[model samples]
Target: MKTGSLIAMLFPAFVMYAQPGKLVWEENFNSNKIDTSVWNFETGTGVNGDWGTGQLDRATDRKQNVAIKKGVKGADSSCLVITTRAEEFMDRKYTSGRINTKGKASWGPGHKIVARVYARDVKSMGQGFAFWMLPDEKPVGQKHMMWPQGGEIDIMEYVGSIPFHNLGSVHYAWSYENNEWQSWNHAHQGFYYSFKDQEVPNPSEPGYGNYPPAKNDTIAGSWGFHDYGINWYQDRIEFFVDSTVYHIHYLNDGATLNFAKDGENEDAIEEINGKRTGVSEYSNHFPEWHPYEHNMYIILSAGVGGSKNTYGGPISDAAKFPCSVFVDWVRVYEL
Candidate 1:
């Protein structure tokens, strides 16, 4: 019964970048509107953040929160905006937007995807801006297998509280030593990689967070435009910021969750692995699951939260309404 309200829009078009390989897909966001032909909005409070972290506000299609407009520099370029607010709506203190290319765009092994994005704001950057992918609905016994088994590819994720850092991660399910179906995410659902100097908590804890505490200015698209690129290989996926490799997730030979053959959703135990109460640590083989070898589609979203217990919670209250994550453009090339 709950639905979203669309606001009046004032946006422009975008230009395509020159890159190698065939230009299979691209979103200029120029149509002065969100071309629904290539994107679908996800409306509601997210499961993990809303159910567990109590972090993000509900997602709506309101133009105030999601719209296309002038680019970061000016109107010469166009961009998509996902804004977060401090206003109350539908039992939530804030509101935002999330969109995905579900039935429209999807990719498998041997592909190159890049999203020119601008996250972080001068006054409001503590929330979260994510560019990731979900599975392309693999048929199971009686339904579509999702999450852990299907796997998650997080191309770029940044939290304002951690300023100057960007995270790359993947999610899958595994069978533990106790033989329980447990879901898991690599590198703390973020790998929590920092491109700048930041203080560490509980340094004694192994793999607690980034080490050496170095400082730099690669602040994950705070200003200008930054490319979050992903090179999807058959056995591994590499994440890059410009030409630098920040994270690489080596995958197994087969599917991570191949429990049911087709038609049915759950396997033997009806359990999922790697469900985090909050951000945690990650490694090569921890929860004991394999990498997912399947197809997935893209998602672009922004939400408020990222201090502590929530998903990017406990951030500076200086971030008020109308905070936004801008997407200059998104392109996928055949490799």
Candidate 2:
């Protein structure tokens, strides 16, 4: 697995097919530096509490908040510049940039990813500029669990005030003895951080988890530069943007985890426990051990701040202050 310029992951099944856009893993920030073999810049803040965006901000190594630079034209070569300047230096006013591939490569179950972005201006409002995945942060049982109790893989979350909107979610911890939290979103072009945490616009319900919103989408424009993907398999997950197909994010529709209809899931178990509560309680909210069943890594960030569970409300003023988010390449395949 070693002996070349890349591709030496050895085990943990991170894929290795090699053809048909099958590069297994890539970064293409086109050399010049910031490669560390496959990325790692991720300083402080996370798990310090409030990455959900009460995000007053912090996470920097500062190359102006991480850079490879070549901007304004979008990925044909060098890209991966995450900026978010509004500084106050750690006491938190705004400082950004985060990178990952934790430990070095990780992926389990099938696996697929595509990056290439340009992201939006994010008009502020509790800013959340991301392209994510996390299950490799290590430490979780003797009590180091985190975020929806250690299970999240967003794929892309643009909320600079929801312009041209786009989101993809998958959180967990539906009640690990009441730590609560749950998810299953594909996001409506008007998600508003889960619509400011529900209890309003009711349509018989779906204002909370159990999948809804984004039935047939394509409208993903903001600052332009598209193409976002996710495949994952082993149960279900298939989302795309420039490659089409809007959303799927499942866990088995036949044996049942919440299939949308046909076999009936009571609107996905009454949006998770309204009364029926029984489908193994929705796979017991995943993350059963060892980084949610074997390796899983990759994170590219351009964050600013959000807390109260991201885009929770009130952050406007066009959010402008050097807010940027771009990345030209990040491949990963073999599913």
Candidate 3:
């Protein structure tokens, strides 16, 4: 494995904030070491497409990529450094940590879910990091359920190409006209929402055609240390970065229910009438809308060379050795 250096980002202070809720669990990273009591290590590569197919293969049973350390005096309380382990023939290399509270800190259906985190030392290009969650497991017969159906909520996702900005998205499934599972393609539908700096791509731009244009800036350096969080409830979900609300999603309801099915077809109508009962039902237990209601754990990792980067191609030759993602702490509250 190619040894890489890690850079740590320093923040000015340590602070915690909560609103009208009970504090259930938290990890401030102030112990100067990972608290094994709250987090369980996730070894090997992830079995999904979000972080690229093969990026996790480079992670081994080594502390070079993930670990806890004392904060630089006056800068941070404690820091978690994620470094990259280089590989031959592979133009890029990255390694990060993933910890989850699945059975340990799992939240039930009705409680609100929230996490407060500060991230920095992100690469200027060719890699990305995220703080998100997915269901711990699916019902036995429902193993076929994919992401949205299984449910995925992205509290904050930062692309290296646009490090200064973050994205918040919720994914779930919807029934289609074709009642049979084989014909579901024409009936499949979903929604995606993202927020970023003003310089980021705007899907609504006129004449932009199907593809959104890309823009770059030095702003990634300015995001040195910032707060990112999410407020998740049974009926709705909201995203925030540094306390600023960027996206709001009310669970799929009647007004927005039409898009839940594939296309306008007899099958679509029947599926809707059969599954959708009421606003509360649609918002709370509807599998198509809230497949992730059971319990979820958190994940944080870095990717080097994936589909998202353009200017730097798949890898950044200029990336200094030992790139790091400093996190102040992760706190979860119930609302």
**Preferred candidate (lDDT higher): 1 or 2:** 1
In model 3, which residue pairs have backbone atoms overlapping below 3 Å?
A: 4-322, 5-321, 5-322, 6-322, 177-267, 177-268, 187-262
In order, the Cα lDDT scores of the candidates are 0.59, 0.54, 0.47
lDDT by residue (tens digit), candidate 2, 1-335? 12210221122112222123456777778766687777788876765444655666688877888888774574698887788778788577778888888879877656678787876455445555777777765453343444555566676776654544456656554335333334532112111112222211223222212211132322423446777767665544544555443334444223232333243222121222112111111222433532234456878876665644454244555567777777888888876
By TM-score, how accurate is candidate 3? 0.66
Return the lDDT, model 3, position 233. Answer: 50
Alpha-carbon RMSD to native, per candidate: 13.4, 19.6, 12.5
lDDT of 3 by residue, 1-335 (tens): 11110110011011122253777776767775667787776755565633433343344335766777675433357766555555542322345456666656655443445444434444545555667777776566554445545556777666545444555665554542122233232221211122343221243221101111123333442245656666665434545566544444445442133334323221111111122111111323243334535677777665555543221125545444455676666766775
Off by over 4 Å in 3: 1-18, 48-57, 73-76, 87-94, 108-118, 140-146, 175-218, 255-289, 308-313
TM-score leaderboard ranking: 1, 3, 2
Which sections of candidate 2 miss by over 4 Å? 1-62, 67-82, 85-98, 109-128, 134-158, 163-167, 170-248, 257-269, 274-296, 303-317, 323-335
Give all TM-scores, in the order shown. 0.71, 0.31, 0.66
How big is the RMSD of model 2? 19.6
**Best prediction by lDDT:** 1
RMSD of 3: 12.5
